[model samples]
Target: METFFSNQKQTLSRAFCLSAAVICLGATNNAWALFSDDEARKAILDLRKSLATTQLELQGEIDKLKADNAELRGKIEGLEKQGEDISSSQKTYYQDLDTRLGNFEPRTATIEGVSGTVQPNEKKAYDDALKAFQAGNLKKADEAFSAFANKYPKSPYLPLALYWGGNSKYANKDYAGSISQLQSLIKRYPNHPRIPAAMVTLGSSQLESGNKIAAKKTFNEIIAKYPDTDAAKDAHQLIAATK
Candidate 1:
């Protein structure tokens, strides 16, 4: 009976130790699971923070690039405008230079049914003389016309200058000078458009110089050659007055 009791006690003690070991193992497994869950949560939070930081960096870079691109575009536009202004200025400068050059160059022009190449200085001289004559400065006109005739002897303006010079001389009451110029014109350019008018002046100059015989001869010649001209009528009147 005593030995049976002793075996029973030993079996009870073994069961108690096994129960304690199972309890300890279960507690250790639960603690490990809790630690693993905390570590996984921390890793997820860290990953999320890193992603947010990376996103912020990328956005900052994008903004900087955009600003840079805008600045570059503005610079390009400014350069283009500067280039256009430079081009315009160059064009204006060249045009002004060309106009200045044109003044010194010879050009084709027509004056009193005479077309030819005329130098700028030559045209200005002729125009100034003609302007003086038209302004009724008789002495200046005579001098200018005489100078022009002597200076540009081969000029197409010679005939007109001589004609005006003769008239100016006559207006100045220089009858001898008038006679000389008119006679020269009549002899040199007999078929000139101013011949009839010049001959009338010649006849009047002769009469004024107390040469009635020559004046009468000139009047008859005018009536014979240019009978329908106004100068011929003037000559007829002068002849009647002399009579």
Candidate 2:
């Protein structure tokens, strides 16, 4: 059989072993809890970093899109303005063309203190005849004026045309033709403003044609009809020369 002291010593050794086992288990559990907390904090930090980076990327993309959109809008506006300007320029160009074309159409006009309806080519005809006459193209002027008289019988330029044609004949030294034209004009337009000038031309043409008696008669008639006028002055000088 065992002694009592030996039994007591064994009981104390068993209690101490049990207490050491409990303390070791408690320390292991505390160490495991601290490790889990540290892992959770590290995971949270990594997740926050990922979120921040994603947000920055998203914001950068949005900013780029906004910039691209603004540039596209500006280009669109510029194209629209350019289109409008082209349209306006085309309109202006057409309007100018229309105005320029309208100039060629016939319209009523006053010529040589005479108001009358002129044809499309009437003014040009008269101007061409007058230009020919002024340029000393006497035959051309006569033919042109004669054609004008025959073409436009009731033209307001009739009296003037006949008058210039007679002058053209005179300048061409066609004394008989000049006298015929001047006499016809006198008989046709008795109250014409060009009568005195016509008489002067007729008398001068008669004198140049060696018809002194006819020339003297014409000058006397002019002096009787238009006294103190330029025609009368010319006639007085002629009559004195003839005498």
Candidate 3:
């Protein structure tokens, strides 16, 4: 009976020790699980923060690139506009230079049924002299026509100039000058359209110079050569008056 009780006591003690060791192991496992959960949560938070910072940096870089691109586009447009303006200015400058050069070059022109190459200065001179004559300045007309005739003897305007010069001299009562000019025109341009009128002037100039015989002879020649002309009618009347 004593031995049975001792065995029972020993078994009870072993059971108590085993139960305490199981409780201690359970507590250590729960603590390890809590620590592992906290470490995982901290790692997740750190990863999220790093991702957010990287996104912000990337966005800043993108915005800077956009602004740089816009600035580059603006500079390119400004350069293009400047190039266009310079090209336009150069074209206008060249056109103006060409026009200035054209004035010095000779050009073809037609004047009074005569077509030829005429110098710019030559045309201007003729125009100025003709303008003076048409303004009814008789002395200026005479001088200008005479100068033109002497200066440009080979000009197509010579016959007209001589005719107008003779008429101007006659109007100024320059009888000797009129006779000389008209005779020159008649001798030089016998088939000219102004011949009949020139001969009539010649007849009148001869009469004014007291050469009636020469005047009568000129009137008869006009009636024989250009009987249908107005100058011939005037010549006939003048001859009747003289007779």
Best by lDDT: 2
Would you list the rank order by lDDT, best first?
2, 1, 3
Task: Estimate, for each residue in 4-36, the C-alpha lDDT of model 3 and write its tens digit.
Answer: 999999999999999999999999999999999
Clashing pairs counted in every model:
0, 0, 0
lDDT of 2 by residue, 1-243 (tens): 469889999999999999999999999999999999999999999999999999999999999999999999999999999999999999999999865654565456555555566666776788899999999899999999999989877777888998999999999999999999999989988878888989999999998898999999999999999887899999988876565
Candidate 2: regions farther than 4 A off: 1-116
What TM-score does prediction 2 earn? 0.54
The TM-score measured for candidate 3 stands at: 0.53
Model 1: per-residue Cα lDDT at residue 227: 97
Task: List the pairs of residues colliding in candidate 3.
Answer: none
Clashes of 3: 0
Candidate lDDT scores, in order, read 0.87, 0.88, 0.85
RMSD of 2: 12.2
lDDT per residue as tens, model 1, 1-243: 999999999999999999999999999999999999999999999999999999999999999999999999999999999999999999999999866765798766655665566664665677788888899998998999899888877666777888889988988989999999988888877888889999998898888889899999999999999999998899989997555
Question: What are the per-model C-alpha RMSD values against the true structure?
Answer: 11.5, 12.2, 12.4
